[model samples]
Target: MLHKLNLEHILFLDIETVPEYKDFDSLSDELKYLWADKTKYQRKEDFTPEEFYERAGIWAEFGKIVCISVGFFSFKGEERSFRTKSFFGEEKEVLIEFKNLIESHFNTPYHLLCAHNGKEFDFPYIARRMIIHGISLPQKLNLFGKKPWEIPHLDTLDLWKFGDYKHFTSLKLLTHILGIPSPKDDIDGSQVREVYYEEQDIDRIIIYCEKDTVAVAQILLRLRQEELLSDDEVISV
Candidate 1:
């Protein structure tokens, strides 16, 4: 079945996010209280809600996207190449650029958006962020009435699960098992907040995001039992 997928029709993407504010103390009184309430159960008795705020980037309500990198496969005869690009900077600007790319280039119903755990994390986070910024959702990301099979988003984690509801696979682990180079060698999601707030380097984040996007495509190729892409075959735009 994997052989039937057209690699050119899919756009593999990954996003980097950080808490909306540099620190929990920066939140408004009302929002701080709300956050505290929302995380009470998850934080438990050991750690206070404020102490858990470092993980706010995983939540759409408390975080904002810093970078969104996307890659697509291109073919000329039997040669395959992966072209990648990233949208970075302010949240609204990043979302706008991403929206334009999806709306203009991959607007067709046949086009798919793929990422590792995208259905749970990347996909909904992008959609919610777009809504918060008053940006219209692109056709592929919007899921107002789409049936299960109709959703165009593909998730590597979901594919690996293969209907095993309790199984959870990280992108790093999957890449290791498939023998693809690890995207998290330099920095992982745990340090994104520190990199964004302390280092204040958007270029570094973009590079990391692009690696993840490429890794997602590589995972897809592995699933299809195809040769992995070499470093020279990937181009950044």
Candidate 2:
């Protein structure tokens, strides 16, 4: 088990998904077919089967990724700098860029990927879409057989759980719990499509994702500090 991780050796990533095609009346039957079991949290009201069948067409055509923001903090002795790279545009092109970045410098032997709920959402979605684009996943993404928890993935949601699964914890809630000030997330996820279409603005989504990356980094810092302090106290005692 990898403990006391070097943040510099970890890749913190987040991805946003859109339908495979867009500007259509109804989602393609094929895209709808791909929508099988992507949901991770419980909604207060159960969606009807027809309602649930929604977004399939959206995912099939454009099936493009709207954004992939990556952030990592590295230390020069004691000073650590947080650096990030965000890709937003055509799914194929954006995915190509994402693949190249992962393949380029992160080509180290192994690096733990830190994400906010990536086990359920981001990781597999990125993998499937990368295959869709005919892009081969990097060698480090070879953590195939391991269960979600078994991998070196650090999910802020799971850590927020504190072992209790009572309520669904959104990233905003997790940030609030950690006393970390989250960005102005007044806009909800449902609004992204409209904002992207009618407003013709992709900046909003990029900004939203950027804030999420910072939140992920902050959560990592908090966890690392707590764990390090705990270890140090044990040593002192």
Best by the TM-score measure:
1
Report the Cα lDDT for candidate 1. Answer: 0.93
The TM-score between candidate 2 and the true structure equals 0.75
CA RMSD of each candidate after superposition: 0.8, 7.2
- Per-residue alpha-carbon lDDT of candidate 1 for residues 1-237, written as tens digits (9 for 90 to 100): 668888898999999999999999999999999999988888989788789999999999999999999999999997889999999888999999999999888989889999999999999999999999999898888899889999998898999999997999899999999999999989999999999999998888888999999999999989888899999999999
Output candidate 2 Cα RMSD. 7.2
**Lowest-sum lDDT 10-residue window in model 1:** 1-10
C-alpha lDDT of all candidate models, in order: 0.93, 0.64
How does model 2 fare in lDDT?
A: 0.64
Error of 2 at 119 (Å): 0.5
Candidate 2 lDDT over 1-237, as tens digits, reads: 233666777777776665444443455565344343343232225763235433432333335578888877656775556676789887778878877877786766556677788766777677777888787876555567866555656677766667886746777777787776674465645666666667768888777776677778777777656421121111100
